[model samples]
Target: MKIELSGDTFYPVGALENFLPQIGRVVELGDLPIAVFRTSDGRIFAALNQNPHPKGGPLAEGIVSGHYLYDPLYDWKIDLTTGLVQAPDTGRVTMFPVKVEEGQVFIAAAVLQQA
Candidate 1:
């Protein structure tokens, strides 16, 4: 399903309950690969599936702790909410706005245009 808000389009990825807590799953947004994560506390987040490190890795395979994702390849800490690599690391992943409604998960299309 698709929802339009203020000219931004939100595309539904899946049901919120389908996502396991602390586990990341890759979903395709057009041609873009997005890493969708549900935190232990039930918060949902979405970001580009590619890690920001020079030696790239799959973000979906990374470990999620709280709101941070530890890169599977280099163990770099990345904030799932802001996409910022924590201090001592330098790089940023592209994050997409996520919304949960009626048990459904949606990701914004605006961020995809910027990516």
Candidate 2:
């Protein structure tokens, strides 16, 4: 399911039902690795697979609690929606827009612009 909107292309990553709640999956857009997460409430979020922390942990391996992801290496709390490293922690991960249509998951090509 590919969608073209105003010159931006949305590439289908996988089926929505395949994204388990509180789990993160890695999808590659060209050379970029994106971490896609699904909350318990069925909301989808996408972010760069790399954590913002100096150690640069793999966000896909992080623990998801609600909309926040706790970095598996540093335990840094990051908001999945905004990619903000919650309080006390500083730095942010790049985030991409995600859309689910008819049970298919799509991630926008805007990430290429960011790259």
Candidate 3:
């Protein structure tokens, strides 16, 4: 789920050690479910845990490779940075801003409303 918090400051959800490289971790921000990722190359990204496909797959369980996540449910490739579904699929997931401060990971709680 996506949630919108009224704050400009990023909220710290967990430490860097809490994230597994090349794996996605689900973090709850209020009522929102966010998928946090730590790439093998040391890049961090945050996206909505809900898959945009009709199956309603959990994106956090998807396989992480480079900047893309391969959804295990439907084998759909999703861009971690943009949350855009790679070719063959035509949908986009919500991408959140992630910040690493002093070894702690923080995600912007702002969520854009879809039309």
Candidate 4:
């Protein structure tokens, strides 16, 4: 379900603690599935759960290293910050804006619409 909060129209997914550093969590925004992550440096990111590779895989289940998410299904390294597939591959993953307010995590509804 989609909930609007402000012009930013962020939908509450969960609390900051819902995500662990170097881990990714799968969350839904409307009908769109997203991979929400928290890096080891206390940074948060959200992206489409599906990998762009022809033989797709679940990105949320991938390994997180720094700002890169290594797709375990095929070992494709993806840049979490930009959603761009790193060297040797030529593809990109869609990314969404994330916000932490009042200890809660929210994703922009606008991004959900785009997805």
Q: Which candidate number would show the highest lDDT if scored against the true structure? A: 3
Give the clashing residue pairs of candidate 3, or none.
Answer: none
lDDT per residue (tens digit) for residues 1-115 in model 1: 1222234679999999889999999999887888999999999999878887887878998899999998879989998888899999998888788899999999888533331
lDDT of each residue in 3-78, candidate 2, tens digit only: 2223457889999988999999999977778899999889999887887777776899888898899887888999
For each candidate in turn, the TM-score is 0.89, 0.88, 0.89, 0.88
For each candidate in the order shown, give its overall lDDT on alpha carbons: 0.85, 0.83, 0.86, 0.84
Instruction: List the lowest-lDDT window of 10 residues for candidate 3.
Output: 1-10
- Model 4 bad stretches (over 4 Å): 1-7, 111-115
For residue 51, model 2's alpha carbon misses the true position, in angstroms, by: 0.7
- Superior by lDDT: candidate 1 or candidate 3: 3
Instruction: Answer with 3 or 4, whichever has the higher TM-score.
Output: 3
Q: Candidate 2: list runs displaced more than 4 Å.
A: 1-7, 111-115
Estimate the lDDT of model 3.
Answer: 0.86
lDDT tens per residue, model 3, 1-115: 4444345568899999999999999999767788999999988998878999987978999999999999999899998888899998878888788889899999887544444
Order of candidate numbers by lDDT, starting with the best: 3, 1, 4, 2
Which candidate would rank higher by TM-score, 1 or 4? 1
Off by over 4 Å in 1: 1-7
